[model samples]
Target chain A: MNRFIARNGPAYAFLLPWFLGFFLLALGPILASLYLSFTRYDMVAEPRWVGFDNYVYMFTRDRRFWKALNVTFTYVALAVPARLIMALVVAMLLDKGLRTIGVYRAIFYLPSLLGSSIAIAILWRQLFAADGVVNRVLADFGIPSHAWITDPNTSIYTLVLLAMWQFGSPMLIFLAGLRSIPRDLYEAAEIDGTPKWRQFLRITLPLLAPVIFFNLVLQTIEAFKTFSSAFIISNGSGAPADSLLFYTVYLFNEAFKFFRMGYASALAWVLLIIIAVFTGIAFLTSKYWVHYENERD
Target chain B: MVEMTRRKLLGTAAAGVAASALVGVPALAATRIRHYWWGNPERDKRTFAVIDLFQKANPGIEVSGETIGWGDYWTKMATQTAGRNMADLVQMDYRYLFEYVRRGALKPLDEYIGKSLMIQDFDKGPIDGGRVDGKLYALNIGANSQVMVYNTRVFQEAGVDADLINWTWDDFAKACEKISAKSGGKVKGADDLALMIEVFESWVRQNGREFYDANGKVAATVDDVATFWQFWADLRKKDVVRSKDKTVILDVPIAESGIAVGDTAMSQFWSNQLVGIQAVSKDKIGAAMVPHKAGGKPGQYIKPSMFMSLSRDVKDPASAIAYMNAWVNDPAITKVLGLERGIPVSQKIRDQLAPGLSEVEKLSINYFTAIQNKVGGLPLPAPKGAGEVRDAFMRTGSDVVLARTSVKDAAASFIDDAQAIIDRAQ
Candidate 1:
């Protein structure tokens, strides 16, 4: 026991700062938010216990809440699948032993690295503006261009494209997963006269299932928590009649703009629950499709 | 192996030192005041100079200046104030003064005034604007009023007369049409209908029906707001004014405004924005009185451009108040800041800064001085949910213009949303 402790003591000591940060910074605020969800805290005055009022109001009276939820889910529905498919396809392309694959990987990973940054969000806003590069291209094609960010019908699509463009991180993870599958598996399938499409469908996809599941869970959580792009592109209030009002953005407005801290806390907790439920569903549903070589034990 | 061990020891020692340092420091050593404001580059330069002056004036005081664009300023202020970590001294706007005061975020200046500060003679309207329920929560830094800014070159090209002081909305529309026709659509007359709201609010106030009642209730009727929107709708249909691009509404620093930058021939803006407009457009830009209804009251008021307020949580209220007094009352600082924050409220500062001003600043100052005697009261204190109300207006207005909802329905919906926001806030 002493030898074991001596061997691992430095490692445990090194992790102490992160653990402390987790408990004090992350966990403390999270717990405070949980407590605040049950009370009225407008920041100016002391908190007053008003159990379930904020949650009740959010679920019942707040149309903005419902609108935000719908927008967020719509975004997740469109963004998550589109992003995963794009990442997977790109990862496969990169894995094909092409020349300058390192450069290709870096180029593909750049947007994801830059994702969630304010500068990139600003760029996204400008790229989709009325006379932006996208619209300028459309204009050159003799098409009448409407204000993409300002138009309610097309604003969400612009965000979807923004989200889809940041598929780099997932692509890198997929590439790693692709690399891990032994070459002998493909060699065996090929020697058995299996076609390229069948080999990909049977071997490549099944092996990549775990990675796909992981990316889906992560991307969905990220999509739900998205705020910067929507906030920046819409100039802090989801523009054109709340078309771009995502859940987190609405929560921000409630907390900061309206000073409804209790309500925002409630919204945050509800969002956590939603994310938890989605993740739980993903895990539960993964058993049928996900092929794990290590599961036999 | 010796080198690796030495390096590892050094790393461990460094980590230990850092950990100990973090644990040992209970509070920051220096007394640092985090000051925040919103302004353009010119204002930023002058503000930093003033900060340097203030630091030199009081050697013991160390101030850290933080600035953001105007659009993000209020949001950051609200968040920080709510979190009880507001800056010691904050540059505030009139729209948020009442809300901040009511929330007890701003320190009342009654005690600090007359002792630590020397405010010159100004009208009771502006002075009272900083007060709520008999407590002076902020100090007026400067004031401005709404005015019509026209491209003189465009007017000349269109053969329209230079004087537009007594021009009615009908006359304004006719002039816009003429300008558009004459310019062959290379220059639009006006950008959008949102500008009409400022005129409507002023008009309504002059008519004894304010946007919000004295009781902080929505006083304007559905028909009142409908008629306001209808005026613009009619003008838009007449091809006199172009509809605002949706994306442009999201952009700030209105000096980038299509009208102010010469994409459109005319615009309505606060008198303070004339300097910024001039900077953007090198061509001839001129000011005129906001066109009023036939035989109607002038309805215009010298709006309190912004205010400087001390935080309630400030450790040293006297020092903060002194700094604010210097910024507002001192002629030297005012000269540096110029009309960037608007015209100075102090007569001494105004006189001192007026002589060396550029042609554009002089024009704005002269135009404002010409109407200062006839101007009405400043706009009323915006209610707690005023931001939401403005957003609701913009949203519903967009809906109406986009034909997603009828004007009447949009107006009614806006009233409903505005009322709900007010009630929720209450």
Candidate 2:
């Protein structure tokens, strides 16, 4: 036992720094945030316990909270499905082995790399502006194009499109998943005279379910925490009648802009609970669809 | 085995020595004073020059200056102040002056005013506006007042005089209609709906009702705000002015304004923005006092463009005050800064620098000087919910324009939202 301990001592010591960082930097802030959820910390003064007040205000009173939730859900509902389908389709096309596969992959992945940055958000703002490139093209086509970002009705959809255009990460994941699916299965299906659509449904989709689940969870989490794009694009007001006021944006305003740190912390906890519930449901529902090749039924 | 043991000992000793040296070094080697301000490129260059001048003059003081876009300045300041890591000296806006002061973030400057700096010649109003509840928390750097800046060529093409001193709202609308017709819709009259509350507050004050009560509560009714909206709404209906897509340049600066870029004939902006407005327009740009209501008192006020305040938690209050004194009161520093800080509040500095002003600066000075007789009381310290109120104003105004709500409903909703925000803060 002593020998075992001695042999592993240096290995454990090597891991100590990372463990300390994880606990102090990551875990510590989360725990602090949990405590702050029950307080009325305005960032200027020390936190004062306000028990359920922030939660109560969020659920029952804060109209902006509801508005933000609606905007976020609308974005996710549209963006997630659209992004997934587009990614899968593009991945399938790329998998067909085009001549300039590397160039195509790079082009497809470029938006994902750039989309989340402030510069791209600024570019997005300019592209949708009244006299901007998009509008000028529309004008060339003899179609009257008003300010897309300035109009309330169409602004959120523009954000959804921006989110959709950055489907490269999910596409790459889907592409890898598709490649991992055995070519023998498709060959066998073809011998049995199975249709291409049926092969895709029976083999490709069922096998790709796990990858889809992974992508969905990750993208949903990222979508919920979205701030920079909305912040920079809307110029921080979520303008045109708060059309782009997402959950994180509202939380930011509460915490920083209004100095309601406790309220924001509560908001953070609620978001965690929401994500937990959603992820739990996704796992629970996966049983009906996801297939494991090695597991016994 | 002996050789391995000696090597291990040497490595351990070397690591120990490195660790000790690293720990022995101070985290902050110098007494660093963080200074934050917002301005244009010209202002930024001038401010940096002043900082260089300060660093040269006072070798002991290490000052770091961060400049951000004006739109983001307050948001960043609010976050930093709330985080309790605010810069030593903050360039403060009048709209947010009371909010920060009431939160106990700003140090009272009364003690340091005469001892650390001299400002006896400056107007009492501008200086006193920086004080809340008799505690001087800020020092006015410069003053700005609202003015109507119009393009001379656009007005000439429309056959309308650009001087708008005696103009009423009706006259303004007529000019806009005429300009639009004459310019073949290339030049509209004004920017998006002039903020309703700003105009409404002024209107209410002119009609003998203060926008805010003595206790700093909103005094105007929903009907008052609705009437203000109706005037602009009518202008929109007549096609004299543009709506959301055409007029309102959301979340951008006055320099990037469509009106200032010659897409429109006139705009309501701060007098100090004349330089920026002129930079965009090839045509001659001129300024006049904002038109008052017919037979009503002028509701214009001399407002502080921005103030410099010391943090309450600052380790060296006297030094911070000294830095502010040098930035604001020093003749050489003021010359370098020019009217980029807005028109200098220090009468001595203003007199010294007035003669050698640029055309834009001269226009700004003349605009302020002409309205010197008609200027109303100084703007009050904004209340706690001022940020929320400003947001509500923008949101509710958009709602009204979209026809999602009546002007009356929008006004009432704004007041309710604003009141709720204040109540929550309290």
Candidate 3:
């Protein structure tokens, strides 16, 4: 015991604070919520055990649950690609080796830094409002204006647009990945009289596949967990025909507003499984396309 | 010095933490209690002033006030309730009173009445509004009812001088149509009131029925709600009310609504909200009774705007109850907090605050006074999971206005969905 303590004591001490936080704050609640998923806990009263009832109802009868799933899935499908493409395009633009690259990177990165904040979400709501700045700008070109944020058919698209606008994080990653690619390969392609588009298709696309896969999986999970902007824009009730009812937003309402903590726990677990499945699919499919420089041919 | 071992070091740190926590608890023998409330900036200011007054009056008691916006209040309270660390004095709403009381989160105030809590002069109606299951769990701080607050300038410009007091639904619709036509579509006649469950309840009560039956089921049929949505849908088609896109921003403060922004001439809200609306609006605002059905009952009822209750885990019930008593019955506190929460329920406080009210407050008071005797009895408290039901109603109503679904289908789905929410909550 003395020898063990002497060998690992300092390292364990260094990790004690995080260990305390994990055990007391994170792990305890995580396990408790897992147990709560099988019960009916309203926060105020005792949790009543009703095994699988919350899950059964969530799967079979909850219309809002289905609606939330539909909205979140649609958002993930649209937002993930839209954001990645925007990020890659911007990263390519910034990769031109300009003298003011640092300044431009900072400027482009500002939106993502501010993206998930309540102030930015509120600003997005105002920007897409009926008589807001977006409409005013559209009016200057004689384009008829529409309420982009509140219209049921168009509201989720506004959130997607917000996601595309805040492509700073992935853009930085892509910029790093682009910088690491060998310039000699591109020069050799140029020497062969390869067209710019074909070079992009053959070399740049294949080389960036690993980075793209990484960003795709990360952004897809982030898209599925979207809450703050959707909650703010939809007034926290998933308004305008439940078009903005993201899964996390619906889970929040079920837990906090309605106090159905147990049901919300079940919903949360289902969301976790959905994200895991998508990530798994992405990983399994990536083997065919993604290549690493260190990997054997 | 002894060489420090891991166990000894951990024991010393634990002892240090325990000592610090113990030192933090007692502050010169003065009783410390927390008072929590949810309101806007104006109400927060008024509430803090009252808290200061209470602290000043009782030097032995130290009161700290915790204020949050309305949206976050319930969530915070639920979390605190779960942790069993709720504030000593909790500001509650009528919709949540039954839920909190049923869950054993509130202390029954009946034992403190006429002792530490003074309410001998209070009226029975407001008092009863705070009772759940025959026990007084909270004290009503203010009483208010629904009313139509209009921009007088827009009304005059549109030449809409219909008898707002005795007007029927048809009269309101005609006036709205005229307002839109006269404005040449520059301004909508009204913000959408169709999604307001309070207005729907009023309509139900006007037809000589309560919104909820004795068994806690919704008494209004799907057809009744369908008709209500159809009325608003026709108005949407005529462009009298704001469109679904403009009207669905329900989370914004009342001061940001269309009527306050001059995009609409009128809006339906509680009487107490008139001061807030008028404060932000440029036009001269006036209040009137909500338009009832022709030859039907007057459905408006004075509602307890909010309540102050002692949490079950209160550390100092005497201090907490005293603060609640002062909140309602004290003239000094009422003078500063006049009509900010709602109209004060105490007769003496109302008499004291009458001359000191601002012009907008006077307008609210006048409308409230005129409609006091004419209103019907208070409706039953909302069922559990009413917050979800209200959201479902608004979603269905918005669907009808957006023309995403027929009114009949939306109403049917809303009824089925809301009932299921209520049943699940049970």
Best by TM-score: 3
| Candidate 2 lDDT tens digits, B258-337 | 56566777777777778877887788888866677788877878888889988866766666777888987777888998
Docking quality level of the chain pair in candidate 3: medium
What DockQ number belongs to candidate 1?
0.49
Candidate 3: segments with Cα more than 4 A from true spot: A1-24, B1-29
Candidate 3: the clashing residue pairs are none
Considering the two chains of model 1, state its CAPRI-style docking category.
medium
Worst 10 residues of 1 chain B by lDDT: B243-252
Which ranking of candidates, highest DockQ first?
3, 2, 1
Q: Which candidate ranks first by lDDT, i.e. highest?
A: 3
Question: How would the candidate models be sorted by lDDT, starting from the highest?
Answer: 3, 1, 2
What are the root-mean-square deviations of the candidates from the true structure over C-alphas? 3.7, 3.7, 3.8
The DockQ of each candidate is: 0.49, 0.55, 0.73
lDDT of 1 by residue, B110-224 (tens): 8766788776365566777788889888788778889888888888889887357667777887888888899887787876654345666776765567788878888877887
Residue B121 C-alpha lDDT in model 1: 67
The 0-to-1 C-alpha lDDT of every candidate, in the order given, reads: 0.81, 0.81, 0.88
TM-score of chain B, candidates 1 onward in order: 0.90, 0.90, 0.93
Q: What is the lDDT of residue B312 in candidate 3?
A: 88
Q: Which stretches of candidate 1 lie over 4 Å from their true place?
A: A1-18, A191-193, B1-34, B57-61, B195-197, B246-248
* Fnat per predicted structure, each in turn: 0.60, 0.60, 0.93
